[model samples]
Target chain A: MANVRLSSIKKSFGKTDVLHGISLDVASGEFISLLGASGCGKTTLLRIVAGLESVTAGGVEIEGVDVTRLPPEKRDIAMMFQSYALLPHLSVSENVRFPLRMRGIGSREEQAEKVAAALETVQLDHLADRRPRQLSGGQQQRVALARAIVSRPKVLLLDEPLSNLDARLREDMQVELIEIHQRLGLTTIFVTHDQEEALSLSDRIVLLNGGKIEQEGTPAEIYSQPETGFASNFIGSANLLPAEIIDGETGPVAKFSDGQTLQLALEVSARGPVTIALRQEDLSLDANGDGPKAKVRTRVFLGARNRYVLGLAGEPLRALTANDVEFSAGQSVGLSIDPQRIRVLPR
Target chain B: MNDRTESLLLALPGLLLLVLAFFMPIGQMLILSVSGPDGVTLSHFVRFLSDPFYLGILWRTVRLSLVITIICAAIGFPLAYIMARVGPKLRLWLVVMVILPLMTSVVVRTFGWMVLLSRSGMIPEMLRDMGLVGRSFALMQTEAAIVIGMVQVLLPFMTLSILGVITRIDGRLEEAARTMGCSFLQSFRTVVLPLALPGIVAGSLLCFTLSASSFVTPNLLGGTRIQVLAASIYKSVTQTPDWPFAAAQAVILFAGILLVLVPYIKMTGPKDG
Candidate 1:
């Protein structure tokens, strides 16, 4: 395993910048996820580390060796493409052994053994002789994973590899991925857009937006305590409302534009206009209660849970409630959230 | 009408045309090939097979065809691969450039080569200037001339067939190979080449058959001495007035192509397992 350090990587296509002076360091044997929506430069950053793309201005050092100018083949890194990218002409075993065979890692017998072991890790040893085309989508993904790890590369780069599978298969593969990473201890860089996958997989999540790192922290730190409105919005898709924080003699109270006041955490220091982020699960809905009143727009049934869309202080809000607790549309409902759960950010 | 009868009725005109225009002439050719002075005989076949001169013509035809096909493949594969990988607009231009020779008349294209390859032509003149060949060295009227001419005439067929296949190959395969420690050339050889075999096989079949049966290019460029099978067949019919002999040579050429193709097709053909 190797530690990768990307220093101020800037990537651009013509005049449009994709990654603007972004720097990151991944320690040895650490799993780092570059998480963002499409076109957020997550894949480009991963490609730069893998040597698949040249940085416009940056230095990539792996194992303390400056490999900025090296090609992917010389970097000793294996990447599993989102498409699986298995060689259709090769059988499953041969596909798994491709990296080993290409890099001349071991003798024929040794390579064969390693390939078999890799396939076994993915529970696909039975289909070893089958061509990639003959296998199902999930099976092909496993073959790709096997090929990636067979070489025992210094680093493994995965580009949204699990996104192509169905939900059940994606969960299975994610669990498999965690087990494989723990067992092998390979320095892995996973690029994905799925927030849940990033939360479950990465040792640290680097959220990207507009070609720059928006936030980078542990999942709990990034999720529960978002530093910016974008972080709150992108992470849990929390509701954001423009509000004013005024020193209301006791501590701080948030005054909504529609003139509804809500208590804030006592230790809060900010005393100007700000944005309030409320997690959907944090808000409690009632027919009548001691909180700001909201008009129920709709209630969506989600089998195990109910999601209520509400208009609060002229802004739309969503709150998750137990399936048994419900409210009809256009009805006035009181919405209450604990002051501790509210995230106040500068407007 | 029922489905089968309806299909047959729809195909009736084509079937009638095939019977009258294709099968009848072939039947007449078969009868003519076997006809002797009085009765059906094998003299024409035996006579052609026994003659060393006729055997030499057949050898030259097969050899030149193989050489032409191999050359076309060697050039066409890389060109087609480049065309496949390039952007759509550039690929379109490359396809047009590759097909430009085919768009021209074969006689015109052959004459263009003749002008360049003749003793006093620009190519030989440049060779003289560069001190690469002797003053007496000429490119025209040789096996090399025929091979060159035929390669040009058939490269489009080879390139287009291969291009159709290469473009369908997922480019991500090569990128994945690279990350797996394969150099660009290694990836092309190990992954791209094997996947493109169907196209290569198809192109080789086209180039070989077309070059083998070629008459104008070889006849015009290789001159009278270097007689390929098709030119020999033409000579038999028009020059010698040997209808049976020409028919026998045509049959031999057909059999020769089949003999080469059957094993080739079997070797590269799709496998079930």
Candidate 2:
């Protein structure tokens, strides 16, 4: 494992800039995720790290060696594509042994041993003789994983490798990934738009937005303390409600467009117009209590829980509450949340 | 109608056309190849096989065709790869350029090669000016002239076949190969070449058969001194007016092509099957 440092990497496609000067330093053996939606250039950043793409401006350093001009093969890195990208002509074992064969890692006998070990790691030893086309989608992905880690390169790059798998397989693969990362401790950069995958897998998440680094932190840190309006809305999909904050008796009061007022945390220093981010689970439905008056638009039953979509102050707000507390559509319900749970951001 | 009978009915016209337009003439040719004045005889086949002149013509035909096919494959593969990877507009232009020779008359194309390849022409004169060849070196009416003319005529078949296959190959596979520590050429050799084997096989088969039996270009370019089996067959029918002997030479050419193809097909055919 080795440290990967990307210094103010800027990439432009002809004229439109894809990645604005973004600098990130990843320590050795750390799992970092570049998380963003489609067209957000997260995959581009990963490709840049893998040397599959050229940087328009910044420098890329690995293990204190500047490799900005090097090709992917010259760089000691392995990448797993989202499409699996297995060679259909080769058998599973041969596919896994490709990097070793290309790099001339060891003698033929040693390469065979490593191939066997990799196939076993993916629990695909029995299918070693089978071609890539003979395997299922999940099995092919496992073979790709085996092929990537077979040579044990200095850094590993994954471009949404789990996005293609079904939900159940994705979870299983996520667990497997965590176990493997723990065992091998390879410095890995994983690019994915799935928030849960990044939160569950990475030591740190670098959230990308419009080709720039929007937020970067540990899962809990970024999840619990989102400073920007975009961050709060993107992560956990927090509801952003436009309101004007004024000094109240105990704390700041947020006055909604419908003249509904809700108390904010005492530590909230913003005293002007701001957007307050309220988590779906934080907002509670009250029948008689004095809170923001919200009209119950719809209730979606999600087995153990009910998602109540409510219209509060001419804006849609969702509440995730227990199935036991039932609310019908068209009912006027009071929306309640703790004063401290309100996160105020500039409008 | 059931699926099988309906399918057969739909294929009936093509089957009838193949038998009438293709197979029946081949049958007539086969009968003519063995016919003598008295009755069915092996005399024509025997005379041709015993004569060293006819054997030399056959040998030269096989050798020149093989060279032309190999050269076409070597040039076609890289050209097809470039055409496959280029932008669509440029790829269309390259396709048009590769196929433009086929669109013209074969006699016209051969005459075009003849102009540039003659002793006093641009190619030989340029080579002499550059001191690449002796003053006595001449290109006209040679085996090489026939090969060059045939290669230009047959290259499109090889290139177009390979391009169709390469176009369908996922671009990501090469990228994956690169990440697996393969250089660009290594990736091409290991990943792209193996996958494109079917196309190469198809293209080589086409180039071999077409170059082997082609009459106009080889006859005009090589002239009478250096003659292939087809040119020899043309001479037998037209000059000597020996219809049976010409048919016999044609049969030999057909059999020889099959002889080369059968072993090649067996070598590259499906392993398990």
Candidate 3:
């Protein structure tokens, strides 16, 4: 395993700048995730690291080698494409042996052994002789994974590899990925838009938005303490309400545009107009609780929990509550949340 | 009518056209090839097979067709690949350029080749000036002339066939290969070429069949002495007026093309099925 350093990496498609001088240093054996929505340049950043895309003006140093101008084949890295991109002409065993064969990793016998071992790792040894088209989607994905790890390159880059799998398979693959990472200890850079996947898999999450790093932190730190409104909103789908922080009788209260007031932490330094991010799961819905009142607009049944979309001060607010709670449309419910959970940000 | 009968009715016009226009002539040719004054005989087939001159013409046709097909594939595969990879607008222009010869009359195109390939023509004169050949060098009335003329006419068929398949291949496969430690050329060889085999095979079949059966280009370019099977067949029908022998040669040519095609079809057909 080796550390990957991308210094001041800038990329542009003609005049439209996609990545605006982003720099990152990943530790050896660390699993770093580049997380963002579609068209947010997360995939582009991952491609740049993989040497699949040329950097406009930056240096890419893998294991301090400064391979900025090197082509992808010259770089000691393996990438699993989002589509799996398995060579359809090759059988599963041949597909898994491709990187080792191309990289000249070992003798023929050694390559075959490594291929068998990699297939075993993904629990796909029985299907080694079958072509990629003969395999199921999940099985194809596993073959892709086996091919990627077979050579054991310095870095493994996965571009939303689990996105195509169904929910159960994705979860299973995610667990398998964690186990593989733990066992192999390969320095991996995973690009994904799914927040939960990034949070669950990565040692560090680098959140990207509009070609720039929005936030970078541990999953818990990012989840519990998102620094920006975008961060809070993106991470936990928090309800961002435009409000004013003013002195109240009890503590600092967030006064909404329509004069609805919600309690904030007493240590909140922002005085005037600010946007407060309230996580959906952090808020409680009640009929007559002593808190800010909101009219329930819609209720969605989500098995164990019910998500309520409420209107507070002429703005949509979402809150997750227990399945036992039942609130109908136009029902006025008290929205109670811990003052500490309110993340106050500058508007 | 029932659904099956209604569908058959819908297809009746095409079936009638196929029977009247296509199969009728072939049936007539087969009948004429075996017909004799006394009875059905193998005399025509025996006469053509026994004669080395007629056999040489057959061999020349098959050999030249193989050569032309190989050359077309050698040039067409890369051309198709470039056309497939380029922008759609550019690809359209390239395709039009490749197919422009086909838009003209085959006789006219062959005459164009004749002009450039004759003794004092532009190509021969240039080669003579460059000292690449003897003083009396001429490209006209040679197998080389026939190949050059035929390749120009048949390249579009080969190129477009391969282009249809190559364009459908996911470009990500090449990129994935590159990431898996393949160089650019290695990626093309290992990934693109193998996936494009069906198109290449299809194009080869078309090129081979067309070159083998083509009479106008070879007759015009290769002249009377260097005879291909099609030219000899034409000579037999028109000059000597030996209808049965001409039909026999035609059947032989048809059989040879089918002989080459069957194995190829079998190779590619089952994998897809």
Q: Per-prediction TM-score, please? A: 0.98, 0.97, 0.98
A106, model 3: CA deviation in Å?
A: 1.2
Q: Rate the local accuracy (lDDT) of all candidates.
A: 0.92, 0.92, 0.94
Candidate 1 backbone collisions, by pair: none
Query: Per-residue lDDT for B1-273 in model 1, tens only?
Result: 899999999999999999999989878888889999999999999998999999999998998999999999999999999999999999989988998987889999999999999999999899999999888999999999999899999999999999999999999899988998899999999999999999999999989999999999999999998999999999989988999989999989988999989987897877856
Leading candidate by lDDT: 3
What are the per-residue Cα lDDT tens digits for candidate 3 across A6-58?
89999999999999989999999999999998988999998998889999999
* 2 versus 3: better DockQ goes to: 3
Model 3 pairs whose backbones collide: none
- Model 3 ranges with Cα > 4 A deviation: none
Give the Cα error of residue A86 in candidate 3, in Å: 0.9
Q: List-wise, what DockQ does each model earn?
A: 0.83, 0.72, 0.81
Worst 10 residues of 1 chain B by lDDT: B264-273
lDDT by residue for model 1 (A1-347), tens? 34899899999999999999998889899999999999999999988988888999989999999999999999989899999999998899999988998899989999999998999999999999999889999999999999999888888999999999999999999999999999999999999999999999889999999899999999899999999998899898899999999988668999988888888999899988999999999999878787888899998999899999999889999999999997878999887889999999988
Off by over 4 Å in 1: none
Best to worst by DockQ, what's the order?
1, 3, 2
